[model samples]
Target chain A: MHVRGLVDGQEFLVKHANGLANGVSELQHLFPAGSNVEDSDALPVIWEKPEEFAAAIDKAVAATQKFVAAAESGDKEAISSAFREVGGSCRGCHDTFRVPQD
Target chain B: MIASGARRLAIAAGLLLQGAAGAADDDLIAQGKYLIHAGGCITCHTEDADDAVPLAGGYALQSPFGTFYAPNITPDKETGIGNWSDEDFLRAFYEGTNPEGDAYFPAFPYTAYSGVRQDELLAMKAYLFSLEPVRKEIPEHDLPAFMSSRLAARAWQLSYFEPARFEPDTTNSSAWNRGAYLVRHLGHCGECHTPRGTLGALLREKELTGNPEGADGESIPNITGDRKDGIGKWSLSDIEYFLDIGMLPDGDFTGGSMSDVIEDNTSHLTPEDRMAIATYLKSLLPAD
Candidate 1:
């Protein structure tokens, strides 16, 4: 993040974080029943805090919906406007709960 | 058993506290650096293409109006802002008035900068200070006949100078504010999107209406949420993804100025900040 320019770092980090979050959420859904889940190194997010997990997904989805609507409209201003909101929701969730790599 | 649990809780709380403090500073500094790139400070500065001297300005901004020279912003006491007080920096930004007490040209983008937050500006200063200083001097701007005086910049500012800070729309979420800060101040989107007056100043009221007769003759597109030419088809995630990797939702990478923008500025910002800009831009009522 420090070495790369602002836009590159932002784009890379946000996308990677979103990908990680998606992967984690998918794993949460695929967890086997009574398969020593408590002993796992996972953050215990979706299973433990279902409401918050749902809320995060909801926010991200809503932001994405807004963005898609803007983009579909083909309005330059609209797309420019909604795009950042989508990126923000991704970062907001990541910063709050996800641990950064060392 | 309760004591052991309490000890674990205390340790976890301490770690969180440490992370929070360190993260905020890091986040702010990171944001400032990104803003500088979005602002495109380097393209006009650094003469050496090989060496990455972020803001030791030496690049030539050629135009029909004149050939403007970017100044060194490295933290050198004699040539750069190494000795500039915070007040000096703020005055230069907020008023388009430089350390020499003279009004700067709109090319400096102080008009947009006026909307920037003080803390963020300070962070940019911190980041600049942290860079390696390159002692290089740029020649003064060479204007054509009948437009030679620097005083003309003062006249332009007097007509267009409306210095103000960014006030977040209270109804909007914090995410929106983050976006507004990046777009309006740091990104200075209007520098290109907004049309310039006959005197080479931005037409503030008609911002982002498109500039077909722009300086480079390349039309700067209208981005005012307009359905026709605006980016209405993008998802927030699409926008974020595009800004991050310069790849459109349709899998196309942006080239030209936007590519440079993605590389320099938008790509470095935090996801939240980038989204904030996207959100704020999306909220704009469509123009045409």
Candidate 2:
């Protein structure tokens, strides 16, 4: 759902402006207390560095909010830039916290 | 006299504009720099050291034949390609032959490079020459006697190598042609992705269908339209995203040599070019 929102461009963003914000905010709550699955691709770095993980989540949330604001404004360029920021935040988190699949 | 002076000023302005245009055209170094990423020269030419000098060339490429050490491509007169003439460089790429006219080992991927345009090759040479030369003499390849012979390379070429330039398909979009040029010539993705014959010749019929064993003996994934084995389900944006940041559709980042490739090559390409690659890949027929 998040991937679609991120890659599907303005139509999806405009349609799911509120839903996108809600979905992104849910990311912060994803790593629960003592929630570690054996087959999960989430790296141990996410758990080992709690503060850093939280910071990454904060970045995502901020970017998502900016995207929502751009969607509301109906400025095409602003929305695109905000969307790119959102993607950048996702990349930043993944680079550090996600295990690479073969 | 006043009219004559004004005419002279106009002529001078015209000359200045022409000079500016020529400068833009002569920026082959910049073009070559971009093409270098397209060629993926750094990944092979540079050693794995964090502070490794670029293109000094000590990377060990392990193949079925043997482990081949990449040579110094820097323009150092004695140790690098500085002494090589333009014709020598072109022939190396075009025929996989050295300046002495001896066949180069297939490990060099000169078979794929053989298809590159002469102008582009010249630009690449220009860019390489522009670099600060690093005088690093790499050791020779650790190969079996049979494989070490230049005759072996010549035999391999006779059987499998066919030198040709990229012929753009007029029926296809310009993007597709660009993609084909990149994949077939510059990127040389087939060198690892495609299955190889006993002689280490790429199986042209099964290009980009994926190799069971690739560089460093890793299993390269099929990138064709095969739903089960290939990237059939990946959207163009998904592929673009993967190239840009090494993120798979399932949210996992890529690992291994591909990870390095993403960092040094694909990540630097323009988004439009990435999309072009994706488009071309998607258009391929599904291969089992």
Best by DockQ: 2
Q: Write model 1 residue lDDT over B49-124, tens digit each, in one string.
A: 5575668887666554777777899988877778888899889889888788888877788888898878778888
TM-score of each: 0.64, 0.74
- Residue-level lDDT of model 2, residues B75-168, one tens digit each, is 9988899999999999999899989999998888888888888888888898899899998999998999997788988998898888867889
DockQ scores for all predicted structures: 0.02, 0.15
User: A50-74, model 2: which lDDT tens digit per residue?
Assistant: 9999998899899879888898776
Off by over 4 Å in 2: A1-102, B1-26
Q: Would you list the C-alpha lDDT of every candidate in the order shown?
A: 0.67, 0.82
Residue B25 deviation, candidate 1, in Å?
Answer: 8.5
Interface RMSD for every prediction, one decimal? Answer: 14.2, 4.5
Error of 2 at B112 (Å): 1.4
Please give, for residues A5-97, the per-residue lDDT of candidate 1 as tens digits.
223334444454455445534543543434435544334554566677567667867766665565455455565556555555555454333
DockQ class, candidate 1: incorrect
